[model samples]
Target: MDAPTGEQLSIRNRDAHAVVTTIGATLRAYEVDGVAYLETFGADEAAPMGSGAVLVPWPNRVAGAVWTHAGERHRLEVTEPARGNASHGLVRREPWTVTAHDADSVSLAVVVEGREGWPFSFRATITYALGDRGLTVTHGLHNLGDHPMPFGVGTHPYPRPGHADPDDCVLRLAATTHLPLDPESMVPTGGPVPITGHDFAAGTPLRDVDLDDAFGGCVPGPDGLVRHSLRGPRGGVELWADPVFGWVQVFTPHAFPGRAGRAVAIEPMTCPPDALNSGIDLLELAPACTWTAAWGLTPLA
Candidate 1:
């Protein structure tokens, strides 16, 4: 197991479950039964750990990993090699501080100051509620700075299907359009792809396709929430996310760092790729405003 790097790591557990809360508003760990549905970096790993939670924020992605704000332009250090975009927000690099902790829930907060291309300040909170089925995560962001803040919130939850083989797993999305990408840098060309390799309009089987693309135009459910889900073969386990999560990026890494290898990453987001420059319907909070979202998981099959 990789030792957590932050100084404020807090571990909580109940029965067969566990939650690792990092000051970074990160659900560093969510475990159910003896199996870890989430991925975590383990021994002999060179990439990152798995089976934990991570937070995302701020102008999610900018063209060329660069952005210009109010006569000022800043270039973010690129974290995504393919597109040269910043990819996930800045919270991933900073440690969140714990706000509250209990038997089953944990809350963390982080303040984002104008850095790189952004020109505002805000405080973000992420709360993870771990239960028997799995976990439900909630996020809240408040603009505390004088200037307006451009922001979006996201979380990376690595879940493990109880089954031994991935061949029995299926991932689904409710998106209607996908952001076309430039092969050289994975940044959006601002064009729409017909949802072919990245399409799951009809709930395609996970085994049939490989993906790492962002899609929008999702159909919101009766509750006014857009949703996405994944199921393991024997129908034993599943996960569902809220509709505010407008875009879903599905990643099937060829050889996951942990476990027996292959794993699927179903990431839900509030906006599509290049939302910063595109001015897409990103979850931006004005000065003194807050934005929030939630999702849950269960097991059956």
Candidate 2:
């Protein structure tokens, strides 16, 4: 047999089941009634295509893997060699501490110590729970250092409706504005721009469209939540987040592990990509202050 994923934890209720790994506190699997909602890989392998990885301290890319803070330029290790940018955040590959677990819920924590380039220590926690609504995830962060910390958070989950080929799925997003990107650097050019054929404000079929874009100007509903959805023939999946999550990234990669053709990644973000450099919607947590945000997924029949 293949080796087990490092320290996997299983949680389930009558409504759903989920597998979480301590490594990166990644969501290894999530299914309802034996139907997979999130594309999953073997436990022995690392997260594929950034599946279920939590991006903290920052999300998406940091252009040139460098940013300026408080008048000092800091360089980060290049995690994305192709673009020479620092992709994702700090803890995706790091082992996290399991603080709590039960039949329907599990919580993991990690500490990020301030290094030379990224200066400032902080503690972060991610909690996952299964319920009738599917899976809910909460991210929390507390600044431990004396100086203020500029940070952002995001989650990468390639959600799919069972049995329906991703190419045929219909995606609907509540966002109105798109963050235009520079073709080469993939960094935002300026403010939000009008969305064209790529728009999902109504509902758009996932037919042949290649997308790796960030969106803002979300039109939240009555409960102060933004909703994005993917619907196929068998069923559908919906991702909703608190208003603090003003940005959502829609990525459709050509091929995904453990899948046939393509996959859709609907990511929720507290800020736009390269926010560290632009200072756009980035959260600044003061010393000893705490920041919290909630997001979840629900299976649609």
TM-score of each: 0.85, 0.96
Candidates' lDDT values, in order?
Answer: 0.64, 0.89
Candidate 1 off by > 4 Å: 7-16, 43-55, 80-83, 197-201, 235-237
What lDDT is reached at residue 13 by model 1?
51
Model 2, 178-248: lDDT tens digits are: 99998788888898887887658778998978889999877788878989999988788999999888899
Estimate the lDDT of model 2: 0.89
Point out where model 2 deviates above 4 Å. Answer: 1-5
Candidate 2 root-mean-square deviation in Å: 1.6
Clashes of 2: 0
lDDT of 1 by residue, 158-211 (tens): 556665455566666778888876667666877655566544655566675676
Backbone clashes per model, in order?
24, 0
- Model 1, CA-based lDDT: 0.64
